[model samples]
Target: MKRISLCLLLTSFVITPFVQASNTESASLDHAQVTYVQATQSQNGSWCFNTQVHHNDQGWKHYADAWQVLDLQGNVLGERKLLHPHDNEQPFTRSLCNVQIKPDLQKVVIRAKCNDHGWGDKTVTVNLLSETGKGFKVTRNNK
Candidate 1:
């Protein structure tokens, strides 16, 4: 009985650190971030955005749930819903197409949303006239 108790204690000591570390890591990554954004204008005049997000997805209970395109005035232009948690995929890319934007708009913002956290603070601003900026790229298919 004493030997079994000692082995159990040793196992707990080893396991405790791992569990604690995992909790800490998850806490730090609870918020999602928009890592990259690619915007393109189609020949039909609609817009498409490819967004990349990073989050520590624990499971269905906690994950990066969606991303959205917003104008400078914070009006939601379009949204892409993520159906499931990408636990194995650290940074995943998703596309939202057929988004109609105002012709006079110069810039737009892309933000990430998580199930646990409503919305993250980190956002990517996409300039319609510029080809590239910080974490975003813009392209136009005139043909």
Candidate 2:
């Protein structure tokens, strides 16, 4: 009975730290994801982008810090920087306006970045020509 009790206690001591470490690593892997985007073109030919991001923000230590609007060739056309962590807001929308986009370009990519993860793999593409795409909406105003 003494040997069994000692073995059980030893096993817990060995396993507890590993379990805690695994949980922490997995939590850090939760990258910020761009869930939606809305792009609008004004009469002056500049663009405006409203991007929505989803992240498991762990306060100021880890959160969705910024998002970017990029052309097809990965050139940054616009960026919106988040000043603070949105702990209570699971998914949030922010906008960047007066972004100059080339007339020949027909699409733009939206990507989200977290303070812990840098940039996420998930991205949303906005079609400026057809004004349609998955997870995105586009509008053009000539007036």
Candidate 3:
């Protein structure tokens, strides 16, 4: 019983992330060269960034989502989100998109919003997988 319980815990933390990563877009912050990245902490203990979305699928109906935060060395300071990622501003999503982050985080939340034609501003949250990035490319494509 002990072994079975341990296995379940490990599997939830280890194996589940891989499956989720496939559904959520992701990128590598580590690259041969440092890329466009920025990270700042909010007074409320959240992370804010202005970066490109990776694997951005193209098309009018096709929507893409990615949020990236790379350090000076192209390492992700924390988790990344991939599209119209956040909005601390008033004109934009109006605080609809935000992030809760911590140092050496055990987990992170990903949020996204969009104005597709008439429908938009959808928000969702997912736990951070055991993976992180350092640097990445800003090309537009869906994976």
Q: Which model scores highest in TM-score? A: 1
**lDDT (Cα atoms) of all candidates against the true structure:** 0.91, 0.87, 0.35
Is 1 or 3 the stronger prediction by TM-score? Answer: 1
Tell me the lDDT of candidate 3.
0.35
Q: Rank the candidates by lDDT, best first.
A: 1, 2, 3
Better of 1 and 2 by lDDT: 1
Better of 1 and 3 by lDDT: 1
lDDT of 1: 0.91
Candidate 3, superposed: residue stretches over 4 Å from native: 1-37, 66-98, 103-133, 136-143
- Across 102-143, the per-residue lDDT of candidate 2 in tens digits comes to 889988899999998798877898889867789998999867
Enumerate residue pairs that collide in model 1: none
Write down the TM-score of every candidate: 0.79, 0.78, 0.27
Give me the runs in candidate 2 sitting further than 4 Å from their true place.
1-29
Kindly indicate the candidate among 2 and 3 with the higher lDDT: 2
Candidate 2 lands at a TM-score of 0.78
